[model samples]
Target: MKIEHLTVQGCNEWNEDALILNERERIYGVLDGATSLSSAVGVETGGYLASRIAKEVFETSELPAGCAPLRSLVLMANERIRTAMLERGVDVNDKNALWAAGIVVVRIGEHQIEYAQTGDCMLVAVYKDGTVRTVTHDQVDHFDEKSRLLWERYSKEGLPPDEVRSRVYETIKQNRLKTNTSEGYAILNGEPELEHYVEHGGLNRIQLSSLLVLTDGLFLPRKSGEPTPSMSDMVALIDEKGLSGYVDWLIANEYDESQQGKYTRLKVADDKTAIRIYFE
Candidate 1:
């Protein structure tokens, strides 16, 4: 298998998304840090610190010889974050002190592929016939319909970035109460117990021609009234153009300042990371 990957920071001053691809070890992963609620609670941005911990833990950990190592990796990463927070005198009980993450991990084997995901990061497999199958779904989508509607409304209101961010933040904060619970979404947040919430699966290697792992930042832009491209359309675009080319088109066509108001998005831009692997 040949691999290509990239990570681009969003419009923000920092990029919270992180990627780890070790083709020699047949390991690929991505983590998106949640935006910080308050910088005063921690030594650095929660998202940045959490992502760094995840990457470090992943890089140093040994490869899994069993079902999958994602659960263990997330568990260790969470412990590292908690230890760091405690060392900095940050209150472990405070939600603001703990960083949360949406993560995806993939391990490619000679005949099979194993994967695990939590939160919104995605893994897509494209078969030789061009059929695309999603290996994991967005945990956020499991939110109540009312919450989803409210978010969509806020996204389309054309509010200032700060105002929009505040609204979104509050909503997420409220939602955090349910995190790792039966009613809430699953994310890595310094809690090893949350491992059970992760989604895992396996795929036959011979049936797949390529695989793509991406964060939500790479989604198609949605217009106020018009429908956005379907997943098939996105896969087609990537097939026609290379991964970089598709990303270039997305930024040029939708994210540029000149294109504002033409499309409605949760954020002006988001930290984008993607890994494309092709099996020969």
Candidate 2:
């Protein structure tokens, strides 16, 4: 197996995304720290800490050599985050102090591939037949469509980026009220019970030739009438430019201000992390 990965911070002051690629163990993960909550807290961002903790747990723990390790891994990671909060005098019960994140984990076995995901992180399996299937879906996308539309409107009106960011932050904060609850999306927020919400599955090793795991940061812009890039397009770009170059293409081609009206999103640039694994 060959694994290539990259984590790039957004245009923000700090990059909050974290990742782990253990080719030897055949375990891979990507974590996206929620920016709104992290910005509100005075200390280190919860998303950053939570992701680091999760990566460390996955790296150091004596995980069982099976598909079931995903659940136990998440549970242990949550426990570690809880203990860290208590030790730091952080109020674990306070939502503001809680580190929250969307996480995806993939473990490649000799004959199969196992995956588990919570929140919006995604996993795309590229089969040998040149077909692509998304294993995980975004949880937050549908939660605040109205707010995103309003932000787009504001952007079209020539609002400053900072003002637009503030508005979106408020919207994200409000939407987070549903996090971990029945009404909201599930995330790794030091709550072990939320593990049940994890979406997981397996694929036959013979069926998949490669895997791409990504945080929500990487997306194709929809130009008025132009078709959004398909999975094959994305894979082709990666094949031609590699992961870092692919992200550079996104920033140059899609995230520019001149492209605003044609390509609008909640955030202009987001921390992008991706892992590409090839079974050779």
Candidate 3:
């Protein structure tokens, strides 16, 4: 088995994303600290702090004899994050104040691959037969798509990027109420019910070529109407471009004038993180 990973700072001053590559424990994945909605507390951004807390949990949590390691670790991580907020005198009940993250973790075993996820980080499985399936869905896309449309509409009206963001700010705020609720997506926000919404499963080890675990930042960005490339398209891209090369390609896409227009992206870039595991 071989593992490769890449992480780059986006527009943020510091990278909010982190990777889990505990080879001794056979646990690996990606974590996207949910971008903080509020100002930083001291030098640490909420998103970055949340992600780091989770990273600590995965790195040091003991696996109990009767517990499911990945699932338990994720839940524990959430609790710790929430605890951190509480210690900081944060109003944990306020969605706006909650530090959060999206995580995709897999524990590779000799005969099977165990995985768990929440929020938007994803996992993709590539087979030996030239096929691929996105094992984890981008839970935040449905709401984001609405924001994207609004952003595009405002941009078409010749609004500046700042104006467009202002126009969509309320919608984005309203979407926060839905987080971890029935109408919204799951995230490790230290909410107790988070475990109910976590995505977990196992895959057979045989004939599996690789597992691509990444954050949404690693997704190939598209214009308003351009179809999101399929799982096969993405894996094939990584094959051709390689991990670092793929990130460069994404950066280039963001800068490509031909791709910019009525539906401009909300941000210039995001903290990109990814881990690819190849089965040899």
Cα TM-score per model: 0.88, 0.87, 0.94
Which scores greater on lDDT, model 2 or model 3? 3
Q: Candidate 2, residue 264: CA error in Å?
A: 2.0
lDDT of 3 by residue, 1-280 (tens): 9999989888778798999987768899889987556545668888899999999877764744334579888999999999999898778878877888999999989999999998889999998997787888889989888998898788778988788898798788788778888789999888897978989989898789999999988876765777765667777888998989989998887767776662347777888999989999
When 1 and 2 are scored with TM-score, the better candidate is 1
Q: How far off is residue 14 in model 1, in Å?
A: 1.2
Please rank every candidate by lDDT, starting with the best. 3, 2, 1
Clash pairs of candidate 2? none
By lDDT, the best candidate is 3
- What's model 3's TM-score? 0.94
Lowest summed lDDT over 10 consecutive residues: which window, candidate 1? 142-151
lDDT (Cα, tens digit) per residue for candidate 2, span 1-280 = 7888889888777777889776557789898887536434555677777888888878764654543467667777778887876776677666655887788998888898888888878888888888888777777767656565767777778999889879887777777767777777878887656766767777787767889998888765555445546666777788788888999998886556678767546666889999999887
List per-candidate RMSD values in Å.
2.8, 2.7, 1.9
Q: How much is 187 displaced in model 2, in angstroms?
A: 0.9
* Candidate 3 least-lDDT 10 residues: 59-68
Q: Model-by-model lDDT, in order?
A: 0.76, 0.77, 0.85
Query: What pairs collide in candidate 3?
Result: none
Q: What lDDT score is found at residue 180 in candidate 3?
A: 85
